[model samples]
Target: MNSQKCYALLIEKPKTFEESERYCETIGGTLVSFSSENEFKILKGRHSKKKFWIGLKQVNEDWEWMDTTAIVYSQWKERNVTRDVFKDQKCMFVSGTGDWHRENCEKKLYFLCKFNRMRLT
Candidate 1:
């Protein structure tokens, strides 16, 4: 089994969500998805005070990862109030403090991408 882990790449340049997604794909990766608080913390520890795009988006009133994987975890801020305001805000981004927030997908921002490490075998 390929037990290699995945790692993230923080592209400092600002780009719209669609552009960012394409960029990651060109490099053999997809936008970063956080499945646990630990993964979020590690990302937070690496980046400084900057907003970065993640892999979460609202589709038909449901939140889903860009890769179409089940959303097993979330770190959304103002969770209770977000549902009401999320109608116009479909794309998700991570704040400096590691909390998640919704934004327009057209807004350009730094983005995070995840690629699996290849086994050296």
Candidate 2:
């Protein structure tokens, strides 16, 4: 039996980032935030071949977690960097290949939600 706790929820519907965040909140979770390689691996394993929104976005010229968590890990894909590009591409999503990409927030895409798992007594 699997005893590992899973607090992530993958919503495979297309929705804007803001809309997705609201949906997560309504379900008692927030947009999923990956803080380590293990967490990323777990998420990737669960949602293979699917691109989804994560809890990351650009804030004040720097990347920040929308859930206000510390930015401890990142897996951004190598690409040309430009101020104009970053300015327009504010939100982020994980690709099916497990790489991160900056995208416009208004772009509709699937999303993942995260919450604290309660231990069963």
TM-score of 2: 0.86
TM-score (C-alpha, index-matched) for candidate 1: 0.86
Q: Estimate the TM-score of every prediction.
A: 0.86, 0.86
Writing each residue's lDDT as its tens digit, candidate 1 over 6-73 gives 75655667999889989988989889887677767877788868789997887786778987867877
lDDT of each: 0.80, 0.81
What's the CA error at residue 14 for candidate 2, in Å?
1.1
Top model number, lDDT = 2
For every candidate, C-alpha RMSD to the true structure in Å: 2.6, 2.9
For candidate 2, lDDT tens digit of each residue in 3-80? 332465556578999998899889888888877888888778888888889989887778888889898888888475
